[model samples]
Target: MTEDLEALRSAPVLETERLLLRPFTAEELDAVAAGEAVAHFAHGFPSAEDMDFARESLMAGGYFFTESVYARLAVVEKSTGEVVGTAGFVGPPIDDELEIVGSLAAGRRNRGYAQEAVTALRGVAFRDPAVTGIRASVPEDNAPAEQVLVAAGFVRRGTPGLETEYFLPRPA
Candidate 1:
């Protein structure tokens, strides 16, 4: 599906009660993918696994505002101006649906940052009109992620266990 690259490029900065969600610049994405420390981050950068994921996602060429519903945003804490995590759509919408992806820094978890980030992303997705809903898949062992999704109003939609899928419909 062809996407409006300009729209993606012009993606807005989203603000929540305690967070700011800003799209990642190509350079920043590259830096993260290379496992280098990003400037202005109080906490350390994303994990090596996350960097690998970012690299693979970038190489796939449809995430990060080129031709997909991507928004590789950095989740920043409003108070300290620290980058606390990463959050956004996994890729372009498929069948008008997309998956929400997020990861808080190891030290930033359990403080409700993930839920706030996901909630803000949901607002951004629904604003587009093309997005009908958002989904998230979490490993069964990842209870924290499940709680985050649940707090954000995502309900489990299928068989529960090892890998569970959750869905949240766009509000009318």
Candidate 2:
């Protein structure tokens, strides 16, 4: 993934009225991977050994970057510029399709940041001629996030209990 890392390191910064999405450096993200910082995406702390595996993978840059995915944006706060979360398409699983995924600071939910941030990322995704739609999988219990996705135009598509999927078409 050396090529993906270099491309991610070179992509342009994305901006919104209240957020800045950009390529995350190891310095910007080590805390999240190291378990030193609190994260809202995972259900619980991983075992220490799991954290170590993740730390090494992140430091080596095995993950796909935005440009490589050609759509995902690393969510950052406008004021602190600290990465508060991740928002964007699935980085590597597919390229022509963008699977929207996001998580905000636990204290920051219900404030419409997810919608605002997703809206901005949508702008980026639609700019690519090859991308025609975006999708997000939200748990059935996550009524708030479901609302945000609908407000952003995603509609329920499928899935069992914890895996319901919603999809929204890319704007012309």
Estimate the TM-score of every prediction.
0.83, 0.73
Model 1 C-alpha lDDT per residue in residues 20-129, reported as the tens digit of each score: 98876677667778877776664666776568666876787734542234766778889988777788876768888888887878888888888778877787788667
| Clashing pairs in model 1, backbone N/Cα/C closer than 3 A | 69-92
Which candidate should be chosen as best, given TM-score against the real structure? 1
The lDDT, on a scale of 0 to 1, for candidate 1 is: 0.76
List per-prediction Cα lDDT, in the order shown: 0.76, 0.64
TM-score of 1: 0.83
- lDDT score, residue 13, model 1? 84
Stretches of candidate 1 exceeding 4 Å from the true structure = 1-9, 61-69, 159-161
**Predicted model with the maximum lDDT:** 1
